[model samples]
Target chain A: MDEEYDAIVLGTGLKECILSGMLSVSGKKVLHIDRNQYYGGDCASITPLEELFKRFGAPSPDETYGRGRDWNVDLIPKFLMANGLLVKLLIHTGVTRYLEFKSVEGSYVYKGGKISKVPVDQKEALASDLMGMFEKRRFRNFLMFVQDVREDDPRTWKDLDPNTTTTQQLYNKFGIDKNTQDFTGHALALYRDDEYLNDPAVQTVRRIKLYSDSLARYGKSPYLYPMYGLGELPQGFARLSAIYGGTYMLDKPVDEIVIENGRAVGIRSGNEVARCKQVYCDPSYVVDRIKKTGRVIRCICLMDHPIPNTRDALSTQIIIPQKQVNRRSDIYVSQVSYTHQVAAKGWFIAMVSTTVETDEPEAEIKPGLDLLGPVKQKFVIVSDYFEPTDNGLESQIFISTSYDATTHFETTCLDVLDIFKRGTGEDFDFSKVKLELGEEEQ
Target chain B: MASVKIPEQKVILCGEFGVGKSSLFRRYAFNTFVASNSRQSTLGLDHINKEYTVNGKVIKLQLWDTGGMERVASITSSYYKFAEAAILVFALDNPASFHVLSQHLLDIVTYAENAKIFLCGNKLDLVGQVPQVTDADMENFCEQCHNLISATFRTSCKSGEGVEQMFAEIARHLVNANRSRMELQTVDKNSFKVTPPEDPTEEPACLC
Candidate 1:
């Protein structure tokens, strides 16, 4: 059969799916194909509990675990920030109609052999057990400055050059101790390492504000999760693409990516030839074009109890700063239970993930996993992270980066926007997206 | 916390591609039918919640439309996890789409396993003009495919025939199944309210 398209995407990862949806909305005839029959390649959620065990090659769960149908376990657990870029994209693209979301209950950070709630607002700050009275005053003042200081207003700057001054100086200016700085940076700003301290303070300041604003939106926490799992996200975007005239073929494999004179012209899949001007795909689709970046270790734990000292939050995130654990990168522990219908009633799923630093990859996430009181069943995987070395300018073949160790979508959204820019050579203007998130699904 | 519980049903529409599955989906869901050609082919898993009052109980149908192109993994992995009902659609005018009826039935049995599956013969308007698979022929084919088809219908999105009746019958089945499950839930001691046992698992998303 002879068919042609303006662009074709080769993988069903979240990053690739977002690009496909955005491209289709831009009025391009897009064709999306995934070698795997399911969506969200490495980042898929396995349902029926038995299927997950099958994927891990483990034995079927006993009757002690509830019915298999009640579980939708994400192999890679992550939470979406309420006011983060991903939510904005969801709203802008009008994918919200296809899904329902519940607010997460708490945001916690690990400190001094224990876990404590993040003080997201003034009320929480005054009652925070992590800080003393005087320190709370200093921290409050610092937060007030952050709340009041507009980057554009000179008076709000208070003589700190956000563009030129490092975040370390800003911390020193407020005399906020290191312990408080750890939670604010690692949990609030959600930075993986201390490197942001060395960079300009503007982005960090903005991130903190974003976190607080997001927390304020939902109050309990700044996170919202779909009823099923993160797997629903790719499906939502896939529906958007289809609404805009994009073609999809799952379980379709590419025999050859026909490059005519160093440009992606067409794809050959089992005698079906569909021409396209450009191609977009995840790193696994085109290995030669990407370079090995690093490795990530993810531990998925099934527990009968909530994480210790999280105030028994139904859904929560706990960040372990690198300095606290004497490591290079921070560890993230995210937990979800039946409240989101991801797991069976009274069952919880906690995942501890971190960037692999040494050969003993499993040992790196020990601090994060220790928070879970008693895990009934655990599945662990270590995968290499990759990035496209060349930007696909020469070949018109844009490739997405591998999924990272972090349990959030900010970094994933960044990768999506970056690929969108490289593929279309224009920034994804959010204003161009109609404010129609409330459009009736029917 | 005050919460209003809504009864929900997960229904999957499974069949081969280009069998007019999207039209049936848009018809049953949107209640606004655009012809078969203008509608875009479904991508991935497309689902919508349509509320129906069955026997005085407001039941929400969580209709899942598989792109009709997904392979075996999509079936084995995610689609059948909690599906209480499945509507396997086939085009009446195109017997080729009907040829795969056995395969779809086998998959629904193997994956969905216990779901109440109904067969729908779509494009009834095109059936006579396009020269024909009879309604009985479709039922005979379903019976040959292991006697698994729970009910059958002849629907046409063009003329708005049988589409409404097909869904109404499916809803009746779903409501009956749900009521039995609820009754069984009360009698069965295994049923619990998913108490807050110090920790919960239904989780959501957070920050960077």
Candidate 2:
């Protein structure tokens, strides 16, 4: 309580924890606190089916389902892209040692009326159940071109400029149909809107490469989830921070972030006071410091069976293309069962989430719920997504953006890296992080 | 230290803040106690890994200390999830801290259903020096708390009294509990029956 910390991180959410761990590993004395005692602030895994029900004001679960202890339903469910930044951070920080990971079973996309497993490679594209004979050939050619693409090689560009050419033009080059473009952009490339097709193709091309590369790693889907839930991620980083001598306090009310001359100076909680130069927290911690940007609607549904046509897969992520549903953003569906140790055997927890565009949020997600068939219990929530109005240069209080509606951590990592850049006044050096991992080992 | 890639178990420490939970953690982890004058509260959730030889097998124990934040309802269940053992610490000199042990025990039972529970009256060195709490009171509290857990230990982080023995006892119990649960783990993963529960009557083996 009396120590002067280099930084005071005030939330155990994934982003804050990562920063805390990284700062601690970088030899910065950090004091991480959370009003909530748990590690993950908003991104916690709620267990004991009855606890989730109680949180929703529902009655205790009857004995029709399996044991309550057999569930680890995530409040904010997300899957880690195998080759994603989060994975890289996990490895670079050695946070991966604290946990076990299971590759997601399938990655499917919603088409006209049905769902289809995303064809990852040439063979899968040809053997795909979702595409026609000639369309399959066109998609295969596109995949081949994408695989041959090299960021540094002009010959791989094939008369097309990825930086200037639009993704729509890239699709047109292969004579791909609109339906195929729908899946390719929203599902494989994991874009949320039509905006990507209008812009340069390089980002989209790289995303496709990330997906294929990650798929190449696990040979099933491009995503990997921890055994229990996304909640373990924050805990893993918290462990990393503790190992590096960072201090952690939970349920301790942060009475005030003492600001001196317009910059954060320290924190006061009850009779104890700790001095710090910089403060980092989530949107909720510094509510007045952030601006309301958007809102997200998430529906957590527990079902006795998997989504039909997912090949009886135990864990899967189904993307509903924004164009298919005529929405501003794509709707994400992520399901994990007892196979991944998130739910009981024969029980599945599927969450449907999307950026809220209209007033009728419940009605907006009808297309997603219809695909879920019958749900045993459904809990719905609409949360405001906020972002810091300005970088913490002035206040020294770096506030992380709210958790996005996406079911993957790509955007989440972008925000984290961006925040790290704005806070450190330097880009987070990947090589330096790896080198530090080696040097700090002894 | 890097993980040894052995069987892993998470053990949680719960109790009031400033009740020597962190002191017990330091004692178990570094084999040293924090000076009382310079002691700082655990910030949030802090953990240290220790490898234990349990029943002829080497198991990694993730000793998690809750930073006295167990009072928060939302975060309490998270600490309990997947925990195989729990050590409920209380300051022997403070009656209020010891009084909250029941609620903390409820958290352990509710989230970590089959976890082995141990009760530790910490700061045991201050028993006679501090007139508020006495040995007779400790005896009576143990008589009641022991009924709720496996065993009770009077520990002093300052004197290193009973800390190692408390952890060793918990480790032994956890190893045995893990072995018994192992036979059922595969079956439990495959079958619909509940993994294992302390109270079988409250929840049927399977289904809801």
Candidate 3:
């Protein structure tokens, strides 16, 4: 209790856990503490159907819900891209040993009041009903250009500057229609809205390439979900930290930050004081350090069947682009069923989330809800979205932002990597990490 | 080639700090103990795998060490969440460590109600000189726990006594319990089966 550490992290959220694991593996002495008894602060997967009901102040579930222990419901569910930084981090830190992942079955896009799979390859592009014959040929050529466009090779640029050329110009060059642009930008690139269209085409192109590459890694889909829901992610990283000599404490009260001269020195949780040179926390721990930027509404629904129009996929992700729905923000729907061990044998868990743009939050998700045939139960949560007021350059009190409404972990990884740079003053060197799990597990 | 899947059980070593939990783990993981080190010097207790054969079937035990988190009442719930078993370690020469078993028992029962608890009295090498906790004391404690403890053992990590026997007993019990629960399910049906690693050939660095 009296030992000083290099850094003290508050919260067991996925972001903090990843940072803790990274810091510990880098040989920094880290003391991680969480106020709640459980791991994964906001993104925890509540188990035993009763606890989910209890937390939402709902009545007890009947026997039809099955054994409560069989269900692992994620409060803030998000999928992992196969080639994304989060997967790389898991492999780099060898945290994959503590977890099991199943590739999400399908990736779909909602347009014109119907959902269709987002085609990534030439075969899917040709067979896709989302585009016409000439449009498919144009989209296929566009896909070929995207696959060949190397960042360093000028021969593949096709006379278009990836950095200076806007996405609108690039789409026009390929003659991609408005509908094609919507899915390409929203579903494939996973942007929240059309704001990226005017920025440079390189980012959106790279995102599409990533989508294709990740899809190639796993033939069914580009996204992966852990077997027992996403709650396993934080625990996996926490175990990685423990393996690297990081100390962890949960169900502990954080009374004060113990600042001196406007710099965080340590944490005092009662009579005992654990001193640390720097403090890393989520936005909730230090309320004064954060400001609400926006609000996100999420509705978790329990169903007896897979989401409609998903080809009976046991797990899938659907993106409702903002423009198609006549809204300012995109709506994300993700579902996982008994195959992932997240629900009972015949049950499926689906979540609808989006950045709130209206007063009627529940009504905002009606479009996504209509996609699910019949929901057995539902829980709605509206939370304030937050980000740190300033980078922790002076206070040495690094903080993470709230989870976004995106159905994937790209944005979350960016926030974590940014905070890692601010807290440690070193870029996370990815080239040095190798996939160590393969040799270790066998 | 068909691969056989050995069921992995997460076994945690927990109790008061300095009660030789790390020492026991070090002894099991590396088969070595440093006598001069008075503090916990373990790098981490990450998946120290030990294979035990039970009724001709092999089971893998993934051992976890608390790393002194219990000293500050900070053992995260994730540590106990999916644990198949827990070894409550107490020093035989320290009665104070024995008295706190109830608190640890309470936590394990609350968080890991399905976990099989085992009582471990460490520092058996010092029993000849000063045995602060007696056999009767352990019996009373086990009774208070309402027979939640499946087994008990006294081990000396220094002398390598009863350590292997204790772990082997845990593996045998777990294998039996699992076999009874699942009724010899196929390897593919095993819980927590590792997902096949991604193809590194196609997965280039994210351009973003």
* Best-performing candidate as measured by DockQ: 3
Model 1 - which docking category?
incorrect
Tens digits of per-residue lDDT, candidate 1, B122-164, equal 8888766545677668768867877777789888887789988
Task: Put down candidate 1 lDDT per residue, A148-249, tens digits, no spaces.
Answer: 777777888999978888999999999999998998889888999889989988888888877876775566887877777888788767767765667777
Instruction: In angstroms, give how far residue B152 of model 2 lies from its true place.
Output: 4.7
Alpha carbon lDDT at B84, candidate 1: 79
Q: How well is each residue in A1-442 modelled by candidate 2, as lDDT tens digits?
A: 6889999999899999888888877778888888875668888788778988999999999987688877888988789887688888887776675566778889999888788878766667777877899998788778778877777788999999888899999999999999889888888888888898898888888988778767755658888888778887888787667656677778779888898899999989998889998998998888778899899999999999998888888889999999888898999998998887788878899999999999999999998999888899999989999989868989988989999987789888888888788888877765544332212222
- Residue B131 local lDDT, model 2: 55
* lDDT digits (tens) for residues A220-279 of candidate 3: 789888877888899888877776778888888999898999899999999989999999
The clash numbers for all candidates, in the given order, read 13, 9, 1
Per-prediction interface RMSD in Å = 9.9, 14.1, 5.7
Of all native A–B interface contacts, model 2 reproduces a fraction of 0.00
Clashing pairs in 3: A48-A68
Order of candidate numbers by TM-score, starting with the best:
3, 1, 2
Which candidate leads the pack in lDDT? 3
